[model samples]
Target: MSTFGKHYRVTTYGESHGRSVGCIVDGCPPGLQLAEQDIQPQMTRRRPGQSALTTPRNEKDKVEIQSGTEFGVTLGSPIALRVLNEDQRPKDYGGGGENIDMFPRPSHADWTYLEKYGVKSSSGGGRSSARETIGRVAAGAIAEKYLKDAYGVEIVAYTNSVGPIELFPSTKEHPSPSTNPAFLDFLNKVTREEVDSFLPVRCPDEKVSQSMSDLIGEFRDREDSIGGTVTCVIRNCPAGLGEPCFDKLEATLGLAMMSLPATKGFEIGSGFGGTRIPGSTHNDAWIKTPAIAPGETKPNVKQPKLTTKTNHSGGIQGGISNGAHIYFNVAFKPPATIGQAQQTTGYDGTEGVLAAKGRHDPCVIPRAVPIVESMAAITVMDALMAQLSREAARDRLQQAGMTNPAMMTATGNGHA
Candidate 1:
């Protein structure tokens, strides 16, 4: 609810050791081409202290855009952005009222955000921090540069697995998923510069990315934290886009990845493993060729019936978009500010033995793969601007019945 797309909305504010975090987007699409060096590479890849397995708290999350652009383009208004919050320790996670701000850190959002807003923020875990997804990877990099400059649309994500060491691609070097190719031809040619050249832990195979970076360095040397799965794909997302039976496009992409911040789970396309097959092998059989792009004729190009040979409905079906290649999966948990030691109870109920501090991330799936490709490019660019406002209101009711013949008998033909 803290705003996300209805039309690429966004919203996000600040909190986790506050002073700055930021967002605001609001229905982008003006003169595109934005700046802040294109939202500082996904806010420096979802910022943290770079790497030693994350969270040493160096936060150089430099973004700024302080207003919908002017010279660098985009004046469709309401952009905002911002970053700051230097290295807000907030005494790690307790300082003000001690007892680690009176307990409650297990599986975070401290006691349901102080029982839904009676007061929370003991620094971090305020907006249920993962630094509140840095305004969703800075408004999903301007809704992925307006869905990759209007519909060449390509959103990639990685990490695929960690807690279980799954990167799938094996002739036996470390492959499993019935032995490689469960999904990956680099997910139809990967790129985010080849997932940052498998840096830190992006996991683009490399023998399961060195066994998922040696199991996140043995759970960051046992201070402990672990959880995984991030897969995303998207390809050229045009077709009918989505929206049916309640804004379905995988239910607004599982409500923009379960409104991120330790997202528990979500799946799409053959998800839940295609319920173990057999709807005649999961029925996606339709085959017509060339909808466009062969003869090079352009009268508002509309060739689009040739996508499925076998997409397992990941490119969405019935719920819309049948262009193909949509894929999904996001699981992320295991980051509730651990440093080990815990017995629980506080805020006056006694008990003791908390032993937590800060500088987290034993494994947040390589910074949650650009926040699941910026919440799937702000939920497929707000379902492709609600299918281009329903094809511009059906081409303005077919151009008002072909240029208003008799203007419907000059507006006096109701029952005359």
Candidate 2:
């Protein structure tokens, strides 16, 4: 399970306190221009010590490409990436007066990890640490580059909420952000630059971003933590990118996002709010694609012949993409390794007060933005490659004069 994807496979290695952490990216198409600079920006964003609201652990998170490229072009082979763990502090977890070595941190992977393997790392959460995501971010950067160069796809994620503060709060009239005109408009146009402009919080909304920053500061000062949500959107994805049954596009997306550390919930499109509306109103109705004036279309991008009048289905239908924007929200729980002292049990079944020691964010939503975007890119890239393989096979069949008349008639309109 450490490896993901069918065509674009990524297998990550190393640990939190390990010498280095990284991944091996397999199946990337050859001849695309790539370099360390292309992957460094996202690594910088995901690294710790970004601002006062984040963990104090300082890591440059500098990435190095070990192989699979020559003269800045991929060789269609497995690419290895690595980032040194420069800020490791194993003694903080056990060597000091702290008893974390004896008791598993509450609500953390410490217990389940030991239970599953009957052993654990001397310090830190090992593979469960947020540091493990460095490899994922690096791999995602490669996938994202391919997606952009080949399909003009754009993936963006931002802090949607911190604690109870939200960019678009649900109300009596609008239980879902999908029902809000302003939310829809923002989704249609928000960019990564705009999202990053509001640093420390990354929520885009001026007033709300400031409020969320203050809220995170409050939690940090109290030696506590809070949970929040991240919203992501994938634009310009081609239609027919998902496989039906178990590998549905959204289902895979949910699997990717939920796999991240501390993620507790996942929902797509209208999400849970759609449950409040009736089926008649919740369903997305199809319509002819909107007409664009001459020169309005972006170069190298294709437009779908059909779209939805309402996107309550979230750009996906019947487990396949419909060439509309795909959006979803990922919920992260509060960081378990807080500075507060809690009454808990130890391995010997004894009761005591355990004051945890470590550097952790009071709120993980801000840094989670890039992680969400990266995971989205990986999922979309995998699905896209799968779809492309099928299309290529069908093309060969048609060119060989083996096309079925009934199938041709069924898809005569050329719609995916």
**Residue range 141-246, candidate 1, lDDT tens digits:** 8888877776667788888787867765233332222112446455777877877788889887677888888888888898998898888898878888888989
Show where candidate 1 strays beyond 4 Å. Answer: 1-15, 22-80, 83-93, 101-104, 109-122, 126-131, 152-260, 289-305, 309-313, 316-322, 325-373, 378-416
**Model 2 CA lDDT for position 183:** 80
TM-score per prediction, in order, is 0.37, 0.97
Give all candidate RMSDs, comma-separated: 18.2, 1.8
1-416: candidate 2 lDDT, tens digit per residue: 68989889999998899999999999999998999999999999999999999999999999999999999999999999999999999988897777999888899888898889999887888999999999999999999999999888999999999999988888888777777778888888999999999998999989999999999999999999999999999988888989889999999999999999999999898889988878888877889988777877562467777898888888899999998889999999999889999999898889888878799999999999999999999999999889989989999999999987557664576547
Can you give the lDDT of residue 31 in candidate 2? 96
Which numbered prediction scores highest in lDDT against the true structure?
2
The worst-scoring run of ten residues by lDDT in candidate 1 lies at 171-180
